[model samples]
Target: MTIHSRAKVHRMFELVEPIATVTFSDVPNEAFLAIGMRNYWDGYFAGRAAPLGMVPAEVVHAVFYNFADGEVARHIPWVWGKTTPAEAIAVRERGSALALRQLIGELADSAELAQVADLATRAGLSAPTEGRVLYAGLQALDVPEEPVAKLWHAATPLREHRGDGHNAALVANGIGGTEAHVLMALAAGMPAEKFGRIHHLPKAQLDGVVDGLRRRGLVDAAGGFTDTGRATKSRIESLTDELAAPPYDVLTPDELDQLIAGLEPIAAAVEAADH
Candidate 1:
């Protein structure tokens, strides 16, 4: 069995997802809260924009077309106008750290998170520091947030950074946006036709992507990944892990071990709260 077995990849994803989710998906009750939602979004965009050198809003607008459609991206000022990139970045570094600290504090005071503090500390140390460019960038802007939130916040940038890297890798390797979408669909086991429909991409274009992938021996006529395709996916995942590992350099081995041991219960508690 390969080390980056599907299960291993999924488990790793599960461990890191909670922290990332609360920062975005777990918005306040209203869709648009004056303070909480905007601040959270500001931090989110800030973290996202860091690698791009705080380019102007128009640059973000131009590039985001690859990720989101015009109507959707155009609706918000963060994506287009009202807030300047500099301000967004500042808010991201300051507000997110503060928010993370407050969230961790709330959880620690009301829940059993204190029991896992040492473990969380250890776990942070355990994360490897090499090849994690995105993680390292976020770490350079490190704040005094509480341990768990700090870890959580730390995890988000690495994840997003890897995603950014993945997009670059795809383009560099001659895969266009449409083809990249198809490859991801194959990796995730979604039907190509359905994926095309859901994403509002044309069937002909998607079929073209699949055909190109087949010619390259990356997929089969049935649109499933060939052995070569699986290998490629694994390589991409490995590359992503390498890119995400740099921030954990600050943690010592013992701290990493304790964090590994401690995170499960805390994660479970977070899940329980969500339900």
Candidate 2:
């Protein structure tokens, strides 16, 4: 894909992602709790990893790429013992659908949603499976017949497909999981405390990562991106976008435009409700 097309593809998926991922917010906790899971991390890891079956923590840690290993190990395997992968998948889909219905209101049942679901499913299934472990797992699942659930199911693999590519880009550039988070934090101007809390990285470890970045001229004294840091961040994102572009090739230009336009308001609704 050309740079322009790659960027467009990235933006399109960005819009589609919230349709499925809004369940990450507290709104969908009841769905997970109903399945006898402990807490958010239990559902988060279990639900996302369900398609891969009862994989161990090491596999989840490797595929997930950026989460702390201990955090992953705290859940996986243990989560599987609590609930089967099929149950986890069901609750995740249920939670996502409930969240979307609540947030989007009538839009959840609209023909536009159905159309976008179809488009996204086509795009997602068209993606190459080579080296995309997470996406491949999602691809093996059956698409749901319910409009909202179908949309979430379809958007998932597309999201994971890009995520797999993003992880590949990070690995190719010699960035470790915590290091990737550090670079992202600096690039986005996210506070160090927030990044540390989210990623479960200790202050000392975060400092070490930052100091390493500084040595490579990727971070400045003020904990912001240096010029080299900004360039490197841009390159990583560009490569991720490029790798993520192939799936969208299934859509005609007009179909792509329709998918993005249809999803924009739905994504906006999710954002509004999430806050």
Candidate 3:
């Protein structure tokens, strides 16, 4: 239904209340005011029987309605529009599906940090309420061991990784030491492109990697890679043999663990700071 501004606050009240689930003890004098947009997410969860949403209306407004972030003191209309529970449900379902598909699919395919980020944006558009969750969740996904997985897991740009392959090829063809540079770039968390440019490599050859993986059914390219792609990532990580003796110069296991822990917050900060 086309919600009216006059009724919007009331509609929000209805959605936020049931999900708040405050008991007598939990209720505070301040609870009466609509849960400040800041607290909505912390006090909430996703899927069913949770807060009206995984995120606050402000976040939804920002994502869907193109509402720029406001300073804390900025005044907002009492109600933007009346969004019913039914509307929230429809919005959530569509958003979640879009998030899961785009974010995961892109991560599986590119294996590069930038591509993963781009997918996060694409998926974010699917469901603003849950887009952050989806975007953050995809990082935790295990990349496969195929070409696609390598592209993603190398955490470098696709072109750079390909250049590493080319460097390797040159070394393999008796020109220079390819494998060490490949490992070094991967270890340093630099994009494959950086290495390629630094080493004066031509464009990395992804066609063969992509095609070979496709022919072997190691990747579900149609869906942006697959379980097979995830497997390929694992294998490549193993082959890099860094897991056993990972380049401490880049990241140690403990350091990697710390990075993973802060991954979501860091990504959010990066996005927030961009504007």
Choose the strongest candidate by lDDT: 2
Q: Positional deviation of 220 in candidate 1, in angstroms?
A: 2.1
Error of 3 at 137 (Å): 34
**TM-score for all predictions?**
0.63, 0.94, 0.19
Every candidate's lDDT:
0.52, 0.83, 0.31
Give the higher-TM-score candidate: 2 or 3. 2
**Candidate 3 structure lDDT:** 0.31
Prediction-by-prediction clash tally: 8, 0, 18
Ranking by lDDT: 2, 1, 3
Residue 249 error, candidate 2, Å? 0.8
Candidate No. with top TM-score: 2
Backbone clashes in model 1, listed as residue pairs: 119-259, 122-255, 122-256, 123-255, 123-259, 125-251, 126-256, 132-246
Question: Which lDDT tens digits does candidate 3 get at residues 1-275?
Answer: 11222232222222222211221112221231133322322212221212223345454333222112331112222211333333333333333333323333443343344443333222222221222332233233334334322222222222122223333333333222333343334446553336652344444443333345456554455424456545544445433222112112233334433433323432333234333
Tens-digit lDDT track of model 1 for 136-242: 45545543346545555555654554555565565546666556666678777897666642356556755776888899999998879999888877776666554
Candidate 2, residues 157-243, lDDT tens digits: the string is 888998999999998888878778887777677955576545566778777878898888888898888898888889999898888
